[model samples]
Target chain A: MLDQAQPMDEHLGFEALYCAHSDAIYRFCLRLCGNPTLAEDLTQEVFVGALQGFHRLKNRSSAKTWLYRVALYRVRAHRSRHESRNVSLEGAAEPRSVSADAQYAMRLDLSQALATLSPAQREAFLLVKCQGLTCSEAASVLRIPVGTVKFRVHRAVNSLQSVLSDTPEASHEM
Target chain B: MRCSSVQRRLSTWANESHRPQEEHRVQVHLDSCEACRQYQSKVTRLDYLASEFKPVTLERDLLPNIERDGVRKGSGYVPRVFFARHWVAIGAAAVMILGATMSTRRGGAYSASAQEAVRGMESTELDRTAYHQSLWQAAGPHQEGQLELLDQVWYEAGKWREKSIPSFGGDRIFEFDKSSGLVRLSRDWRGKIISQEETSPRPKQIDLQEFCKQAGIEGAEANAEDLGTRTLNGVSVREISIPTYNLQRTLVWLIPGTNLPVRMERQNEQHGSWTTSWLFTIEYAKSWPPSIFDSSTLESTTGGPTARASQPFHDAESGTTNESRLSQRSKLPNRNQPAFRTGNIVFAAYLSTTKPGPIDSACASERVAAQLRRPLDSLASEYGTLQSYGSDSHDTDKDRAAGSKDQVYNLRFGNHPVRSVMSFTLGSDGVWKATSLKVASSATP
Candidate 1:
């Protein structure tokens, strides 16, 4: 039994942290891996790493941001490990669009457009656009310069526009 | 401003956070230049479209998954140095054993003494038994710390009751009624019952016989060895050692007369070091009253049934209380609704107009549906369907909040056959809203 006054109970604190941010982390992994099952596995693995390194976590304020950073690294490592087996990130399964509603269809079109962006751009775009992180924050998560994040987001937007324009509905809407 | 300057700042301008001077310059350029204006509009549209992509929800609650995989405190740690040298042999043997165990139905071998001991323990009947136990784990070199005490447990075959008195505060009682298939947990804070919850336990049977056999103890090919007799806690016991394919050494201390386990210890050899993984000591008792297992006794001993105020009353007709039943019914999707099948995934939506009664209201007097109608007829709507791989009936928890039921739903989309999930919860207004929706590629077929 651990002392209640201890700054943190390793298992319980990690469980609390997981409960608070697992959904966001799952969404991040889902977008990055393009496979829900793989994303789930990656999410579990990320937390396992978080548990092992919990004692070393210096600043608790940036736990969410720190988790994202860890997730990004794990995703990269997974891709690299699978790359030798001919498992391409883009080749991962795509989500099927069930609703024929124009809005739903357009969302699906945007998902496809997102897939066409470079991996770096996609990461930046997801952090800034999907995850609502600022450029500077995204840079910190990705361990890149703020300028690189901006450039990636800019390129991602441009590529998405170009790809979406190829479809008649998106072109007409624009 | 030059068209070149405006072109460079186009992204910044579209993001709507440009400096006032830059914004004015970009606006002037856009107003005057058709090409830049088209470019600016396209960027804005792209941003809008991207923002419209809903955040995906996980098909299942990940907390349980995390808890399942989460490392427990004081679990033995195996250094990487040890793993590097012996991991290959261990991994090969583990894979072979796991394959054999899963693929075949044949029982494994057990020593005659081990079998007799297990049979004796299983055959021994008791009206009720009470015992106290203290659990300990190794912290570091030269340190073994007390983890917890099983304070007390009243056991009667399928039904078992246990209470935990934490070091800091509060006492928790866990009662499992196997026949009823319900596990009730009540927590007492400073002698006041603070919280109580009832939930159905997962339908998994603990097969001790199968477990012993799988540990390479029972089968003809088993490598179980008798390490002679030893006295544990003043009781003379026979010691048996079983080495498993996973590099785990299991030491069982069995009483020859009763064939009951007095103490068991498991150690794992990894990376050239042996670490104690688990240790359990059992003390048996002959009898206790059947009434000891009742919740009423717990309440009387602790206090009055004050905690019952927080829980919904159980309904006799339906297993669930009326409050939970209405909540469940209010959330169920329309069965007549068409399911959307895209790729290997199928989706469905359920919308309801029912208003739930007040939380603590009696089942008979409360209107099942609300009297105050919403502007929209339907208060809630949910989209998603659970399609398990091979299970005939969809296994779902009735007491779970509307959208977050725990079940394995097939979520394969596009060419990738990954599992996906989507669920919703009902707000106070009786409107169903998706709590989570997620799709992931399956690692296994």
Candidate 2:
């Protein structure tokens, strides 16, 4: 939130990167991994990995992007390590399908829809809509063309809308 | 409006197109058009509803705490730099001497401006040969010892190998800590549950296979195919991929650090792999207590499903006699080539010009009805495969291996979508095999 990437060389500077972005990263990871504990551990891991490979960081100014890249990359690697775990490409719940916890229901359906989209599409949508990255920034993080990133986001959004529309409540919500 | 034009406008307005001038026209047109207006409303609703998918924001204070804990404990990357100035070296007499050097980003370690540090750094002399020699061998004293330490850790961990065995297709599992010279093998059954997730299928059908069985997968059919070699996280490994076998292709990365495949993957056909990259080194727990290996993975496949059958059985491929020759070649050294043959037979059954004649001809054991006909009464379904009007033997009967020597029994499919799916055959060993199973007609690309 506050130019979170600390000065690369200073002892205090390194601490600031963690202070600034760790929680945001942890939260992002929790949503991605669908587990709070794992998200927390992964947040630790992402930073640890960043530390291990910190010397490779040629430009410190792009530290925020770099951190996000590391977090997302670790998430990807974790997904791959447990690669066979099946996360179906189908809607999990509808808006009406979630009544007890309205906030949770919405999140569940959003997650459900996001899970259905390809990984690239999900990353694009999250980076642009949720994390508030510009298409270019998201593209840089993803190392894809801006046009591809835009396409992925649009496709993800359209599919998510369709997945949500499947529920009678999402239909009404729609 | 043309359907295409309407679709474009609908897409643009749904995206909240960024042009101010066009916004007026779109809004005016949408206001008049109920269908378009309904679509926009639907889209707006979706947007409000989309936030549910986002992660919960962390408490503002969590970062500082984590940062504080992480910095001291974290590992750092240092770089390769030398203090000798080329100009200074050339100008100096026979004696070599240097004063000091300062810069940012050196020796795989991140450091701020060297001049700004609290104390001026001392340049320590490094012996090049000795440093290289130490890498092949471990850096510390305990490096050259037996894995007694890790064995003790595995014994105490309790879950040494119970959890992870099910995930793999029964390949050797080993982990090496370069820092510590310990190689933990799964005593014919050992591994840690590195990760596990419950499968949530939307339609809630029974899973693809009953109870993720460690069914007797004879051996890894993985061999050199579309191969790629590169050093991944300092582990020199070879990565190979096969496009078919299932909707998702399989990738096996064989780590040179250990002769085993350290990583495995099943990538979706469409997006390839979302997480194939960014795989770095696997960090072990700082220390494993002595109680790790007390638990057991011995009966994992023994009782549940494959207990009795997992023991090597003669399939159409297994090197046993009861099975036919065609099935045996399907298990050739060129792993995919043989499977490619069996898959061809499977495809042929799907695309036979003659139906009902022989879904499986080799099962006949001996010469039976040479002229088997398709059951025309049964409407051709996707399962029966689109049968045509002739047999494969009817096409030419000439083969390079046979030279018209042996007769091939093939039911041909006519009026087919692709000319490629027509031809099928057995190998030089008289095993039923096909060139490739191309189901491009299914629109799966």
**Per-residue lDDT of model 2, residues B224-293, tens digit only:** 2537675666757767553322223445555444333334343332123221111111112223221121
TM-score of chain A of each: 0.74, 0.71
RMSD of each: 23.1, 27.6
DockQ of 2: 0.08
Model 1: residues with Cα > 4 Å off, grouped in runs: A1-16, A55-61, A87-108, A166-174, B1-34, B73-445
- Estimate, for each residue in B176-284, the C-alpha lDDT of model 1 and write its tens digit: 4435433333333334333333333221222333435433233312666788998765767888776643445667766675444545555555335454443334344
